[model samples]
Target: MSGCHDCADCPAAKFPPPPAKAAHVIAIVGPPNSGKSTLFNRLTGLHQKVANFPGVTVEHHVGRLRADTDREVLLVDLPGVYSLLPHSEDERVTHDVLTGLRPGMEPEAVLLILDCTNLGRHLLLAAPILNLKLPTLVILNMADDLRNRGGQVDVAKLSAELGAPVALISASSGEGVDKVYQFIQGTAAGRAKVKAPLIQLPVLQDIPKCRRWASEVGAGAAYRAPEPPRWTRRLDAVFLHPWAGPLIFLAVVILVFQSIFAWATPVMDGMKTLVEASGAWVAPHIPTPLLRSLVVDGVWSGVGSVLVFLPQILLLFFFIGILEDSGYLARAALIADRTMRKFGLQGKSFIPLLSAYACAVPAVMSARTIENKRDRIATIMIAPLMTCSARLPVYTLIIAAFLPNRPLLGPILGTQAAALLGLYVLGFLAAVLTARLLKSSILKSGGTPFVLEMPPYRWPTLRSISLRLVDRARVFLRKAGTVILVVALLLWVAAHLPLQNGKPPEIGQSFAGQIGHAMEPVIKPLGFDWKIGIGLLTSLAARETIVATLGTIYGMEGEAASHGLQQALHADLTPGGALALLIFFAFAMQCMSTLAIVRRETGGWRWPAAQFAYMGLLAYAGAFLANQLAGGAVTRLIAFLQ
Candidate 1:
């Protein structure tokens, strides 16, 4: 009989035949800044999920790996730990998972990833992990850096000394990654044997025997120091300076924002033309008025509204990847910490806040890294106020139509750019105030001490950055696409219902119109017509839906202009009305998806409901104040000129 068939005759096989395939659970562990996350991303590609552990705010990232023809491996990325003996909440998570003591899971094997250049220090944690008696593999990542520093490693000798499979890998370049996969496959097939490495820890006087063992095992595997990169040191000089660093960071941010509009203008204009042409094409062929309205007003308007901002979104993510990959993001956080702290936030909060500029869902999810309950909650609460890219469509439409193009003082501050800057400032102010209010009231509690590891600056791989950008774009298209589509259909149905006298009722007399008219008594004081009121209501599903809702309300012919929605609004709306609309969008909590994510993250409806309530009231108050002040000021200016 074949060796694989032996189990068929055994008593254990009475119920059913056991499959020959073996499943291995591999946990990847490393110290902070050791490229553990980069390795995880490389191995998993896009197949991963982030879940919360029971009763804790920590995130658990799990991905599946098919390492061989017969075996499937489950890869778990544990939080980075400084030592096996935990000192913080996140570190405890790592400790528990490694020891198979974590609440709901146990790993069958462990992959210990270490930075090659810092092997001596990394071995401190490796010693304790080895004592668990689990099958283990050691990966010396960043081998490229080691080789570039004129340092070399003898892999065969190192493996023999360490008593574990050892592989030298450059995670970013995918070098030596295949060897890791091969080793895992062999181990899962029961064809590979690894003895527990003897670890000698001279520094740990409390465990002399363990120390001696680690020393003997690590001797040949370790290498002498290599020269540090001169460019890293030179860049650090300017990037880490207390006074000059923040200024440089602000300048970079300004340039990135400016480039978003400047670089994406051509693509955006082309998309606008294409959308208008498509609308014109559909209008003539469709005979039924209702069907025609749905196609032109609902699908065309809504999808077109969101797609027009694709260029801006892509450009924003492109720069975000560059900053994150180049390691400037951490330095920016360090420099902004003092200012952020004054508002009851830590330096690490900058990551989530900055992420919110792309979208708030990921920003809230990223807040799990904040250990303190109070800080995490406060960060989640304020993240949505950070002017996400979705707001750009509304802002672009308003500013282009209403804001003058004249230069102020110099070319540096054109009136158009200045108005955009003012909106961002308002968003920042809103986030700061919201954070402060939450800290003192509902979320009043002390936060854990912030201790972040700053990684050395390195050149980000172009391939990796491009891949990440594409991944983010896909995610946006998937999640936001569905929500926008449904909301658009609903808006179309609402605005087109209750046909009167065999002709489709105008928007002012339809179902959405009646609702808006009923609410007009309240919103009219803010200078909003019923049409604008309807736009605000639909926008609650997603902020960008306002543009689509407006396009639909104005009818098909109006939406087909070269200037598109902006020109339509300029011809249709008075300056005071435009100002009121901008203010409304600026402060509104206009995304239900963000609310649902908050509920999931916070584990209750209380926080999300409260967030919606407060933001809605704030939006109304801000819009009312702006309309009154702006309208009165314009009237007085006109009288003065006359």
Candidate 2:
């Protein structure tokens, strides 16, 4: 009844044929913990771009093959998933793209990367993908690890079993990756040649059938699963123990905090001297007074202050990258599950929360992997409460100014490092309490099971860790140049306005001063003066902006003009005010970028609005209390010592 009587006269006959050999756009996909990302980086190097998929906050990496030829292949590194079935946002994006249902360049072929050491389970994912029947090359990554551990797999036999070509490579060390390039180019060239289409395999509709198929395919291919490494089992015995595990994790945290101060001090000082020398060298070149002031006092001083802490921030990320790449972070998550359950969160939330230490934007976006909506929102809501790198400048500035560098634990930890660690603990405690409150109230939901595959331990490669630090530094420097630079220029204009006799007014009578004075009454209870009030307002753009704001203001002031930021702050803020500032930053939601991402993730302004108001109120009350109590205690201690 629905037959097309005019089939020969259809629109297909009128339109021109598609290209003979279109540019190849291959997809690199695999299960979590597979060496897919490493392979992608190996093939693309620094010639890659990252952007979010359409209609979602999830990001995908697009890169061209780093080949020395005219022909190029565009590779989309889709989010890692175990199967094509859409359980979470990541899986859904991968599924849509592979199926040609999404608005993007459909993959001409797929590079199915999997860990050869664990072929039984990894091959389970191959079933659904092979049914799609695209030109697929099953890339068994970590071949060196497999062979070192006595695992063996016949690549030719495996290729025959799956009815697709296969290759083995060590993505980390760049071993045998040329086979990947060959396959890509060959697939592209083959597109122009006509051949008989292969018959489609029956669909794998259920997990049991898929599993049976995978097992049979493995048996046929002579796939031998690798023996678990001896060191991994031994390490797990201690690191994954019931009681000792958490204590070890705590010790690791303490070591990281102590090292942040002790190890990074000299590097920070060197950076500070370099910034000052550059400013001094350039200050005399500008002829006009206002131009000199803007260049030397405003832009250089403000941005330079934040740049000094780059060493400390990178040190923090260095440790994080090592922990993650070494596979200890996953074990840490398992250990934290017990405590997470007590606070109404699951173990799966730990990774995102831990990632928040570096930045909250990606941490929030990573929550798309959580299956439960309520649990996902709760993680998003509390992610900002973690002490991110933006808070490092404020914390280090205040701590270094007020707290002495006296050693608290001999050579292990110092007074300043202890103070920094306490601030971190305070933030984490606040996040847990807030999670408890939210989970018990509006966002309440039933507990969902958290199952994560434990990755084998491996020594972190230097190349990977260095790459991470480089990326972090680029992001930090970019912000300093753009956002911080623009803010400094605007502040300088405001601080020198309404000139009398064509000369700049004193800071007290300038437009910036009047604005700060108006807000002074509101922050007076927290031991803040007019200058700090101005810094607080500007900090809403970014938490690190407060440091830059203070730097610009102090550069304009006459007193302590030659001193560094630490001395300038000591001249203005009391010990209590210094403590209050740290407490305020720990509790406040001072990042506009974080707020915008939260709004996008939650799909409305309600969550971010509520989050902003709650954090603001908490910061004010906490700072007020610290000012009243700690101020007196510190004064008494100083007098007693004298």
Best by lDDT: 2
Off by over 4 Å in 2: 1-23, 190-205, 241-251, 345-429, 438-447, 479-481, 498-500, 524-532, 538-586, 590-612, 621-642
Please provide, for model 1 over 1-642, each residue's C-alpha lDDT reduced to its tens digit, 9 standing for 90 to 100.
122232322212322222664446679998877888778878877655554444444555666674453655667888887677665667777788777776335777788898877676676666777667677888989898888887766778777766777889999888999987887777666676648554433343245555455445556665655577666788989987777887898887676656665676688779978997999898989998888888997888767756665666677667767877788877876777887789888776776787677667667755655656677889999898888877997898787776657777597887677778888899889989999998888777645466666667888877767766665555455545665678778877877888888767888888888999899899888878787888888887779767767877776333454267676676766667677777777788898667756765675577888888888888888888877778767446434533
Give the alpha-carbon lDDT of every model.
0.73, 0.77
TM-score of each predicted structure versus truth: 0.76, 0.77
lDDT of 2 by residue, 1-642 (tens): 023232222222222224553446789989988988889888987656554554455556777787753345778899888989887788888998898876435888899999888888888788878867788888999999999999999988888777788899999999889999888877766652222213233356687777777778888888888888878898999998877888998887666656565676788779978887898899889998888888986788667755765776677678767877798877876877787778898766766676677667556755654556677889998899999877987898888777767776898998778889999999999999999999999888755456766788988888887776775565455543455566667777777887878888876678878889998988988999998987887787678777766877777432353248888888888888888999999999987656756765665578889999988998999999999888989657545534
Report RMSD (Å) for each prediction in the order shown. 7.6, 8.0
TM-score of 1: 0.76
Q: Pairs clashing in candidate 1?
A: 198-213, 199-213, 199-214, 200-211, 200-213, 200-214, 200-215, 201-211
Candidate 2 lDDT score at position 30: 98
Predicted structure 2: lDDT? 0.77
